[model samples]
Target: MTRRAVFAGWWVVAGAFLCMLTGYAVAYSFAAFFGALESEFGARRGEISLVFSISAFLYFLLGFPAGLIADRTGPRPVVVGGLLLIALGLVAAAQADTLWQVYAGYGLGVGLGIGFSYVPSVAAVQRWFVRRRGTASGIAVAGIGVGTLVGAPVAHWLIAAIGWRHTYLVLAAVAVAGALLSGWLVRPGPERYGLTPDGDPPLPSGASTMPAGLGLGEAVRSGPFWSIYAGALLMSFGLFVPFVHLAPYASDVGLGEGFGVLLIVLLGVGSTVGRFLFASVTGWIGRRLSFALMYVGAAAMLVLWSQSTSAPALVAFALLFGAFYGGFVAIAPSLAADYFGGRALGSVIGALYSGVAFGALLGSPVAGYAYDFFQSYTGAILAGAALCLVSFAITLAMPEPARWLAARRPGP
Candidate 1:
């Protein structure tokens, strides 16, 4: 790649980070808004959660279509439009007073926006880097950490000061600026620049070709694909419970609410470090090993949550668990790339990501129901821990893809 191509590549990565910041600021920032929504809207916990759940569902449900759209159209405009919709959702949310309005803003508006942006950003990033794809993707998606660290605190402050309505307005402003910038920075792939995905030359003569892209039918038939899919589902099952419950759980145990928000920031710190660390290591350790470690380590961290009552203990739990969570964000996309070629990477990964959405659809409610039934988060934590163990096993079962093996074979 020329210096110009290299610069363009980094610019695209930067755009992915920006897109992630917007998406995650909305996704991860939900915790801070939960309490306010319950109080201001007179909705039950389940009802309030249903709004966000619907949003998560729509995001995952729409991932396949969005990926198809990105493949057929391009990444830049899709991302830009999605950010605009997110901004509109926030603005509409700022005006919401009824349950239906809340549903509209939180569920429909944000859900559709996330559908447009998140997967395309990753697909675009993967198309840019080949040799160091893991590292590149990690850095690109690390915007989740930045959003958590910065957006969580700002969200808390905004909620306290102007109330949730104006907070949405502020987020809307940020989203619009981000969308405008992303429109300029991002483009489809190296293909537009007369290069292939990963900047590789055309296939060499007599290279064995596996089926290029697996449809959902073919994907379901493959053992390795199902393994990766199952792992993602398990990861999501546990992923949001800690975050969604962290504030209320802390307050229930007599810790300050502010500390609950601070714990999120702490989690973000761990996430920032974890993304870089895991990305760097995946290139050395390889994908399967790194994925297996992430799940096993996450399970250990989830179990540690049962020991948390004090602020310090909880903080420790968050740090460790947060790293594992961020590690998944880094590795999962690369895992998709490894198992499937880059050909239908967007749609295939989108389908896999739907499994995550399904888990999220179940996770928070189960935790909430468990808390309501048992009057503690203990049962939920244990369940999540068990799910992490299951994910570890599934990841461990993944076979090395035939392509990676074929690439290593000696040629005549």
Candidate 2:
């Protein structure tokens, strides 16, 4: 295809981006709703937090099966189905008269939708490009940054205007429309269209398009896999803490509600820039270094967060934390695909993210409990920073892609 023709893989990236944008916007926007939910239900911080915890746990936990199913079937159907569930869940949450109903509707429905759609959509993008894989993956997942950039503020505004129930209803409508459009844009792998990765050309009648790499079992048994898993698990324990508590912390410290929510907006901005910037630099600095630096930077920012009670300090923490976090998130898929092969890419990614899923389940709620016990966020913030240092240390031990492949390449 000519440069004028535009590659098919970019379209896949676009679709995946939109799917993630919708899913994560809805997912992360829970933070914006945190106060409202607590007020509405007359619940404590730790108890109300379980809603997000349940949602995160389900999506990450279910990602393994959801990915396997997508590997067998096409991602379009899976994404479409997931989006429908998200909309249904939002509608249910809108009508919820109790917290348990909210748990069922928002928690289960949104979680299941994301589980089914996220990994599959991401893996599909990886199949479309090799030369530009890093750039493509970063752009695709940057939807998360964009979504967060847009979703929380929008949700916050809507909540103030109409209240949280109606805000969810609005989000549901957006999710439904985005899902349909994204699913339509989502296509099968390049082979389905007789094209090679990066849209090189039409292949010979049966020219293999699949990249050679380790299968799920082989990948699971590797040291690199476990190391990556452990790193994600530890880093994740504090990852969602800010999303859930930043606003509340600001409130407690005397920053107004508007500014607290704006912190998330700035986070989105930094995250979007980081995704693009880091992806651009990956070819030069290399993935392992990028991965390690992200953790270190995140650790430093979390340390900053523990001390950030002033407006400028809080803003600095948000932007810096978001920049590092965005890079961290944008690189995961490409890193995993680089370590393993794309043979069962979706399932491998699903398995890897299970660590993150478990971490997310505990991250927010544990922070909430910490707040309840300590009456402050300092301990949790510091803990998250310490975990980041450990992640940095562990990831530092990882071998470069060439060495890793040389040492543990899969046999036919």
Which candidate leads the pack in TM-score? 2
Per-residue error for 81 in candidate 2, Å, reads 0.9
**How well does candidate 2 match the true structure in TM-score terms?**
0.96
Question: In model 1, what are the clashing residue pairs, if there are any?
Answer: none
What are the per-residue Cα lDDT tens digits for candidate 2 across 1-412?
Answer: 6457888889999999999999989988887898899999998888788888888888888788877888889789999999899999999999999999999999999999998888999999988878789999999999989988998899999999999999999999999998998999888788777788887765566554657678889989999899899999999989888887888888889987788889988888889889988887789989888998999999999999898789999889889889899999888889988888788888999998888888889988888998999898888889988998999999999998878897764677
Off by over 4 Å in 2: 1-3, 202-210, 409-412
Per-residue lDDT tens digits for candidate 1, residues 1-412, read 6453454667888999989887778777777887888788776666766677778877877787788889778888889998888889889988987978988887788888888888988888887776768878998889887877777788999999999999999998888998988778878877567655554564565332323545555665677777888888887777777777787777788997788888888788888888888888887878888988998888888888877898789999888888888888888888887777667777877888888888878788777777767788787788888888898888777666655446545898
Deviation of model 2 at 340, angstroms: 0.9
- Candidate 1 stretches greater than 4 Å from native: 1-5, 196-220, 402-412
**Model 1 alpha-carbon miss at residue 242, Å:** 1.6
